[model samples]
Target: MPQQSAEALTSQQKTTSRRPAGTLYRGREGMWSWVLHRITGVAIFFFLLVHILDTALVRVSPEAYNAVIESYKTPIMGLGEAALVAAIVFHAFNGLRIILIDFWNAKYQKVMFYVVIGLWVVTMLGFLPRHLYNVFNN
Candidate 1:
């Protein structure tokens, strides 16, 4: 038998390096969703800590609490609100997805991408109008 040429080896490597046939065991959509859920949950938890600290200032001194509240009543605070909303929405929707996965035995491993997209669209559409109304009115 003749030894394979370098060019032939390269071509063989390209074709044979195909993905393993199975349920994309790793780096699947469900895994990505799980990761995003954890990340957003942690971010939201950090924000909650700050929020609690700020509110706790009221117990220590009303003046300090009032100052923090006043700072939050600004355009920059609206951005914070948006971030909070996003985190909460992601957490809530993903939590529900998790529950569905458990109860219905759904194949979220396959549909997780669409599930996330749908969650984002529905959450934004549901919240945007109310947020805009409050912003404009107040």
Candidate 2:
């Protein structure tokens, strides 16, 4: 038998005292924001892979790139284009907020989060109408 130090005992107690994983979900705003940040990050990674492939098409031939561009001109694809832009915008702003919280004293993190959200909304409102107009008008 080995003697466990007080620090080790306290750490073990903390780990075992937690609720089960399934029951741990509190559904708070911060939790939701964290989850969304991760989801958007993965989506952006996959989109980047596809974007790189499409960009490579231009090296193959102008016709190859033009074909890809022409396919993206559909109204349905336009909606997706708008969503892609939105995800990019949200991900970038949220990433900055995360960096600020991680590096700075961020005492008012919840209020800062609301500010991030407000900025996101304003950015979307400013861009979406113009994007949608370009989408349908083309």
Candidate 3:
């Protein structure tokens, strides 16, 4: 308070002039990727739990298991299965990308993220039509 030096004043001004940090993620690609990864992981975990429980029903009662399996054959469930596939594909590819990032310590994460999206789109394109046909035509 007695005497502020020029450097100190300039630095204080710089700090005050800058915008404040906003959201936790700042709405960046990395944030979205991180969010999607966690969401998909939780989703996959729940799906696996349900699948295991339903499959275990076979040991208890075959008719109950068959009924549950048949209930999944509807068009609505077909669409849900497609969404599950999309989540799995994204989660898997992003996991590989994350592994590569950790292994090589590269700076191409943004590009790799786009690559993951591209691959997911291509894979879904290749898989969806046939899967949907089978789902609906049956």
Candidate 4:
């Protein structure tokens, strides 16, 4: 048996460490949608917590509750509402997709991605016009 030289061992280590050529990380659409859904759901949940707490202030005192509601009536709050709506829509629709995948055994993982994207686009298009109208009218 021949012992490898130090240079030969280093060369072998480099080759072993290098990734195989032409091997790309092909992430599935379903995986990406799942990640985004979890993130948005968490964000929406946090906002809901704050909203509930603020509304609870009304039980303690009407003035405090009114102040909080007045703050939410501003344009910034409108934008925040729009964001919350988006998050809810995404979470709901994607959750349905996940359910379908689980029960229906639909192998259309990539289709799930496209469906989520399409839903998001349609939702924004539908909501933006209404939001803009309200903003301008008020």
What TM-score would each prediction reach against the true structure? 0.72, 0.75, 0.82, 0.78
Clashing pairs in 4: none
Candidates' RMSD to native: 4.9, 5.3, 3.7, 4.4
TM-score of 2: 0.75
Using lDDT as the measure, name the better of candidate 1 and candidate 3. 3
- lDDT string for model 1 (44-134, tens) is 9899899889989989999988888888877667767877898888888888888888888765545855776687889888897787667
Model-by-model lDDT, in order?
Answer: 0.79, 0.84, 0.91, 0.82
Question: After best superposition, candidate 2 residue 78: deviation in angstroms?
Answer: 1.5
Order the candidate numbers by lDDT, best to worst.
Answer: 3, 2, 4, 1
In model 3, residue pairs whose N, Cα or C atoms come closer than 3 Å (at least 3 residues apart or on different chains), thus clashing, are none
Candidate 4 deviant stretches above 4 angstroms: 1-26
Question: How far in Å is the alpha carbon of 112 misplaced in model 4?
Answer: 1.9
Q: For candidate 3, give the lDDT.
A: 0.91
Q: For model 3, what is the alpha-carbon lDDT of residue 43? A: 93
Candidate 4 has an lDDT of 0.82
Candidate 2 per-residue lDDT over residues 80-110, each given as its tens digit: 8888878888889888888988999667677
Instruction: List residue ranges in candidate 2 displaced over 4 A.
Output: 1-24
Deviation of model 2 at 21, angstroms:
16
For model 4, residues 6-124, the per-residue Cα lDDT tens digits are 77888899986775445433355655786889999899989989989998998899998998888888888888888888888888888888888888877786887788789988988
Candidates ranked by TM-score? 3, 4, 2, 1
Model 3 worst lDDT run, 10 consecutive residues: 19-28
